[model samples]
Target: MGKLKLLIVDDVEDNRLVLRAICKKLENFEIKEAEDGLEAVEITQDWLPDIILMDVMMPKMDGYEASKIIKNLYPQTVIIVVTAVTDPNMQKNMSEIGVDTYIHKPIDKELILFKLQSIGASIRLKQGQFKTLSKKNALNPFNSDIRSFRIIFDITDTESMMDFGMWLFDQCADKDVVACGRLDLIVELFYKLMRQGMKNQENLSIIVEESYEEIYITIKFENIIVLEPRMVDILNAFESEFIVQKNILCAKLKKYIEEKNSNFEAERTTLTEETIQEIVELKIVKEIHTAPSKERELLRQSFTQKTCAADYVSDIGGDIVDEILDLASLDEEWRERLTTFEEIPSDDNLKKFANGVLDVYAHTINSLFEFTALAYALTSLGIFLKEKAHMVVQDPAKIKTLIMLLENLGYDLVAWRKHIFELQDTLDIHYLDSSFFSSCMQIEGIMSNKEIDVDDDNDMEFF
Candidate 1:
């Protein structure tokens, strides 16, 4: 980590000096002075200082307003208030407005240094989270009004999560029908990656700059641990222009936001509401179909050059859900039967579960040429259970193992189908390889009394 950027905000020149002197004594921070809260906010816009020493008593935008605005915009930046105000209510107000901590006006060198050091240590530990300006991204910090969010976003908030990708899909999908499902799926996957990357952190965030023509997003993350190579390949497939340095993924999404010129605007002779509605709808449809063929091409291209996909894992960028749907409609019978077997791990229940899986795979999925390997694996597992159902039911530990594997594959199968078939736009292809194959091998190992190194530390390098 580089020198910690500190912004000292105080109306009084001497107070600024005193704080600067204290910070200088530490010999660590790269300090800058702000005469008032307003200047502090303005400086924060571009500089994005690591920490701020804000004074409550300031002219032209007090500390309360400054703190609120700064914290709302850049929640990652730590703000510590320096004030003489001893009232509990005043302190409470500062805390409410997002002052990280406070020091008495008669500054204690030790106390202030302690706070700075403590916060600085934490900042250094989570080092890769700092967003650096990337050349590939077109977000002009001096000009663009970037909306920085440090939010606790839930993964399930598919409709509600407001990020560049979701905003692109939900807000603009009506304009371009091609961009709807695919764009939404890719974005939702990115968000899931964000959640996984920042699972250990208290807050996850991405800086967004929206304009009429483009969306520039600076995603600050510690890591994206792509456990499954298939998911890494899928994630790497996003065609957006992104520059990943350390952990910050700065991406630029373009071409969709620009409005295409419409002759319908002028051709409408009538001032009636219906005519206006017709014009708007026609324009949106035109944008979707005619104008964004180029946009579709941009999104359709597999962006990332590198992937963890193995040589034999040749068939990728496939529509597995569509394939399954074409073969057979996903009934909950197989999944339900698996669950039933878990409740009663008897020979009959196990046989029923095996039969359910075999029935689904042999009848529907066996015809798919691309997924023949998966078909074989699943069928083999089914046959394994059907042949050894009595033996499997006798061992509780072995039953437990089979149950875990079946339940995971079952959950993933259900989730993938639901996301793709329903109005939702999230899907995972990792199940085709990692989840399905691992479970198959492990269960077969358990049945044959052979050791399987299921937890192989396979690494996939991702930028």
Candidate 2:
């Protein structure tokens, strides 16, 4: 509740005046003015501001360099880039230099106030001064010097999980620990993991450790189910481009199986000699239909040859076969059965088998998507805190590094979205549920407001 500090950095006197006027409209803000980035840095070094409204283009040193310098010195200070430059590349560059938020020129008064209020709320939350309810319960009292705590639960115990989450929040609240939304993230992650079919009796453990400088939490589980290969790809969507391609391939494979099944009865009776000759020429029977090889090279060769031969049947027939083979290899029994078959199985059986395989893959993919959505949700909260939290600010170096990771993740999410659309177009199937992408969209909604419910119990609110 102390007076929040504000630094307005702009080269133009008029621009500075405009920003100053905007800040005055908000409550309890002590304002400072700087004409350029260099002066901004100097002012920040002498007097650390809680929030800085900085213009990108300036004389001598640009806002980009100034912001970087100021952030390097004071990572806790929130920097909002106010500029007329709308070029995405420039905006991205600003983000790289540790700018937390952006406000374009011809700023609306309402937007400015909203941004200020949002940042203020985060700062108060971090400072551990923001209180949501008056009633105090006789739970464990918060301690500033406490270093660590551990809690364990049965995976199926939702009540225990909720109780633990609430207890953790209460401890932080009592201690005035500014976790920068980490508490919510931990609870949300637990919810997601539980929904992903964690074994009933498995142990889910959380360890929270704090130092004078940083607080760290780690969640662990023993006897947890391992992720399927497809799920692994989806979880790694941020780092890899193969997820969309894999999904597209899977859909095509499923369609191919369906088509082959429908035409099997007819092809069985009216098969032509030339059709047989083409099959022979493609050497499908010789290369892939023969003895199965355990060697990876042989499998790769078989996949290539079969896929190439399948191309003669349909435009993407080869790709479909390749994907089917790849998917079947995921299971040892299916791999052996597929290798031993003299010809493609009866249409009905093949269709059923392919559908079964795809169902499992889809289920795993859904779980992975849910995991990622929760991660993004957590990151969105972190992004909010990065813009607002002053207590327990992370090391400036670490914050910069995390900002880079966040930027990369944002780009990957966009790529993933575009790839999903492309897959839908190609397969005429909507593999991704609407909720998958909508969860990410919710991040923006979260950042704009202060009315999120953080307590599992209905009696208390965190913000």
Backbone clash pairs for candidate 1 read: 176-288
Which digits, one per residue and each the tens of the lDDT, describe model 1 over residues 91-197?
Answer: 55554444555666666685466456645654654475334222233323332222221112232332223323333332333233223223323444455555465
Where is the poorest 10-residue window by lDDT in model 2? 251-260
Quick one: best TM-score, which candidate?
Answer: 2
lDDT by residue (tens digit), candidate 2, 1-463: 6989999998899988888887898878899999999999989988989889888878999988888777655656888888776575775455444466666567767556655665665676557765431112211134322223212233345444543444444443223232222222233333444444444555565433222222334445554444556345434432321222221211000001011112222435664564455446435412321111122112122111112222222432344334433433335433333333213333333334333432333333232221222232333333343343332122343334323333433443333334332222222112222222333233223434324332213321111
- The C-alpha stretches of model 1 lying farther than 4 A from their native spots are 128-463
Model 2 steric clash pairs = none
The predictions' CA RMSDs to the true structure, in order, are 21.8, 27.1
Clashes of each: 1, 0
